[model samples]
Target: MQHQPPARDLPASWPPERTAWLNTGAPMPLLGLGTFRLRDREAVRLSLHAALENGYRLVDTAAVYGNEAAIGSALRELLPRCGLSREDIFLTSKLSPRDHGEAPTEAACLRSLQELGCDYLDLYLIHWPGTQGHPQGDKGNKERRQLSWRALERLHESGKLRAIGVSNYTIQHLRELLASCRVPPAVLQVEFHPQLAQSELLDFCRQKGIHLQAYSSLGTGQLVGRPEVVNVAERQGRTPAQVLLRWALRQGVSVIPKSASPARVAENSQLWNWDLTHADMEELSTLDCGKRYCWDPSSVA
Candidate 1:
């Protein structure tokens, strides 16, 4: 069996400053801008401006998001303005569920690169474990994902995807991949928040040297105003959004919170240089009653 990097439980720089070393030996920013529904070109431009100015080095997108072209155009127009270059940022996109098996997955990754106007992606992910239009429990889902991972592995080896990962995978899905993948995943992106803590999955990722990155850390904005979250924010003198996002950071998971507003984009990047007290961390942990505001991958076979 081929050996890989051993898991390190916390970021090398726990109170991460500019960047932290990922399992692939690449430095990743602590916070990133998630461009899920942010497709408008102008909105993408303004948000990219705010995010780069506020020290965000990572921009996460997916092919199905229908915004890669706009984001690519925005970056072309904005990076030079920010006094940065292509190498200065970590760009990430995902393989769509529509392209599941090996050939389609490989072609889709290439298409995303062209759409994003990049010769290579800093990171790429299998957007989901199941094939599009397939029932979650479909037996073929497992084999399809296995083939998709093979495609990603080839891309990683080709330097097209500097790192490869999976998004929206459950523990079972990860275990299935880990058993056979030549390149172990560098990250696992999921709908993680106070309500959906995903404690078990987080632990497994830590044990396996895979980074757990959180999306929908605010429960799709629903938990921002909750009495518990608000109380912590009030006590900490920060926005509820900040408090909720900080909760994940304290637990050592990376976060990508999507926002179209410029101010909100900058606000989410203010996670550095602060600490959420133990009391607040504990308080937020109690909110984890197994709630999920995003799609649940557990139903997938």
Candidate 2:
């Protein structure tokens, strides 16, 4: 039988100081396992186990992802066996577009918490600024977003959510939210990669002290084959995925790169042991061409 390596010891501080601190003072892992589109029950269970076993403590899911229950099951079964606890992990989930109004938003959060079998989430997010069943140009959409945010704020105040934020929010949406928000968003989750750098938004979030969490950080696998990324990978003797993830880490943005394969999950978690040179960072920065692999929220308003 082939010998498998023992799981790495959980660090005293899992992600170290590089991890971003939320406005609520909670530490969020800079790297996590993204569960977007990871819907199959067995697949999610196996992947969650593999990710946790490899030392991934941050797991991102959403009401729309349809796998929170699967992840919950995995955690219930795996945590005790792995010698970890609920507090040892930073769990995050999002409110779906369908649940944008105040009442529906609260209900959605409760359902998500029940499904995940957790009493409180480390972080919760407004999955998108646009509301479901509403036209994009409808003025009511903005009101719906505000209502949902208010619900999240209440949840955060009630201690059901340690931190609250939004995903796919552009500068316009953020400005609108900030005007009346009692609790400023602690994080902003968005699609970020070498191709779609969104430098302006990144600057805005940094100035506001909102940690940017990146989804689709690999550009949905399109970036791995790019000449610039490949060159950097070859020089560093790392895989293209690792090179891309390290680039995001170096920029101080949190990243959640999902993979069903155990080997890839292990490979993705090895970013902490190396450093990327300034020249390499500069070269990768030049690859930005405004390419977007996921939904564009720029036109939402």
Candidate 3:
């Protein structure tokens, strides 16, 4: 069954308490800045600075994103100016599929730490269930996943990773990991939007106390053009992007939306202090058609 927290009255402020407690008892900001496919260092620096100025406390990056150093530079330059410290921000990065074995995974984490100039990560995730060089049908795929997960467990024990989790894992993959994992996953990052609800997965994670986080929450700019989303935005006096983000938050999930534009970054962070009506929620929910703006992991096996 899906878990539903009772709705409270709307607040009369700009930044509401938009945090969810992880299994580790640490508070994670629900809305964050995602750095994916952002290769330009100068652009990344400017965008990240703007995001921090706009009240984004959480920043998500991955080794595959190839922008960790850029983000690190931005943070180093902007944190003190913004009157914040490292502890005040939540930083997350993922292990690449190419580094799936135990030793490689551990090495990769250390490398990421060095590149980001951080002593530890707020959260680390397995980028995917499958290995990079190994074929999908390779018998060692599952073993590799298990080994990498074990490495993550050890890192968690060492306090290098405050929380550990996986991304792009389906129900079957999650079940397998749960069966053998010594430490339960604290979060599951996946491609989520109004058009790809993944209701079953969301319910299963909720029951297991795994915080579900949505990536590509705006459908990579497709949902903004949808009539349903636009209509809801018009009625609620919010932007189409805000309406989509609010829809995700209403499902008790966290969302990380990416934008290099300063204006868009500030606009996306304005999700607090308001909400959508029940009728609007239902209308948006009915638009789910399994559309994915990112890679599909259902066939990872």
| Top-scoring candidate (lDDT) | 3
Local distance difference test, each candidate: 0.87, 0.87, 0.88
Q: For model 2, which pairs clash?
A: none
Name model 3 segments beyond 4 Å from true: 1-16
Off by over 4 Å in 2: 1-15
Q: Write the per-residue lDDT of candidate 2 for residues 275-294, one digit (tens) a residue.
A: 78998889898999999898
Per-residue alpha-carbon lDDT of model 3 for 40-159, expressed as tens digits? 988888778888888788899999999999889889989899888887788999999999999999999999999899999989999999999877767788899999999999999999
**Where is the poorest 10-residue window by lDDT in model 3?**
6-15
Every candidate's CA RMSD: 3.7, 6.1, 3.9
Off by over 4 Å in 1: 1-16
